[model samples]
Target: MGNIIQLSKSSPTSEWIDMSNQGTDCFLELLIMAANDLEKTNHQEKLISFLKDQKDINDIAPGTAGFKLDEMPWCDETLIDDASFLICVTKEAQSESVLSKLPYKVNTEIVFPWLKQFAVLIELMITASER
Candidate 1:
């Protein structure tokens, strides 16, 4: 069993996101929920689109993720290093200082759990920003 990540707005209602394939959408949703709108810049938009593309392809063929982590035409992010099942890449997103770089891999199995924690990070950043 995987861990549970809970989230809710200003209501009595709540949602529990399981930290696994079932919560893939939650990760993608969290990317969208990020406070800075990456879509505003054409380059940033491409990065966002690339993220969706990689995730979709990953859901279909998990092994193909390694090849997809190459140089992006729209952004300066690049693969800094890699191993048999992992790829480390440059981080270019605007974020809270807790992180100096973006997650350096394309595997959903890895990303989902990391994203669960990232969701909390984003929520805290957003909540703090609004205050």
Candidate 2:
């Protein structure tokens, strides 16, 4: 569907993650860590399946964008002005100018409670990568 986004890592680490015990506390911690780690690499391929490639960010407002990894939620990165998804990245991580060009908006109200599940899923992903 158009509401899909896929991201692929060139050199995915060999790590496996577990989600059986994923909850509020565990998910956020791991997610922040994983995000930090992913920022280290260059060329983070972001594919917006819901919108055409090279389309204007305004073209896809309020749409769910899927990730290559199904375990992760369909991140809604639409922004009223511009995408701020890269704001979550740390200074230590790689600085990709492309991220700044992407339209992103943070949904704290919607995303706050889901941090736990996010962390748990990351654990499973990392664990699976390790295997």
Candidate 3:
């Protein structure tokens, strides 16, 4: 089974921070870089296809195909929004057979750390943008 990574904010009442124009632009650039990396490795397509197939076989409610790589939130984003997306994707992926597969099982370990780093970056950017 793939390792499931869950991210949670320590406080729910934290003030929401908006990303500065520069920070938003930088986030878009970073997101593109990440998306390109996934595409180059074919992981993006594999994930999409896996989700689609799983939905089909399981008779899962339609529209559970998960988010496209581009549809994922950028770094200058809210924790609640990002966390919700992550939770949804994780649950769908875990319910599918793909989680136990080779690359996915391996990728889980590799990807989660990067995601955590990205989350940290988001928090930092939010703080920086506030000043």
By TM-score, rank the candidates, best first: 1, 2, 3
For model 1 the local lDDT of residue 66 reads: 22
TM-score of 3: 0.26
Residues 1-131 of candidate 3: C-alpha lDDT, one tens digit per residue: 11111122332223222233332222223333333333222343443343345334324332232222323334443434443343334333323243343232333443444444445534543454468
lDDT score at residue 122, model 3, on the 0-100 scale? 41
Best first by lDDT, ranked = 1, 3, 2
Full-model lDDT for every candidate: 0.38, 0.30, 0.35
- Residue 113 error, candidate 3, Å: 0.9
lDDT of 1 by residue, 62-109 (tens): 434322122333332321111100111112122332132334334445
lDDT of 3 at 104: 22
Tens digit per residue, CA lDDT, model 2, 49-117:
212221233234323322334432333333211112322332212223422322453333443334433
Weakest ten-residue segment in model 3 by summed lDDT: 1-10
Q: Residue-pair clashes per candidate, as listed?
A: 0, 24, 0
Best by TM-score: 1
User: Which of the numbered candidates is closest to the native, going by highest lDDT?
Assistant: 1
Q: What TM-score number comes out for model 1? A: 0.33
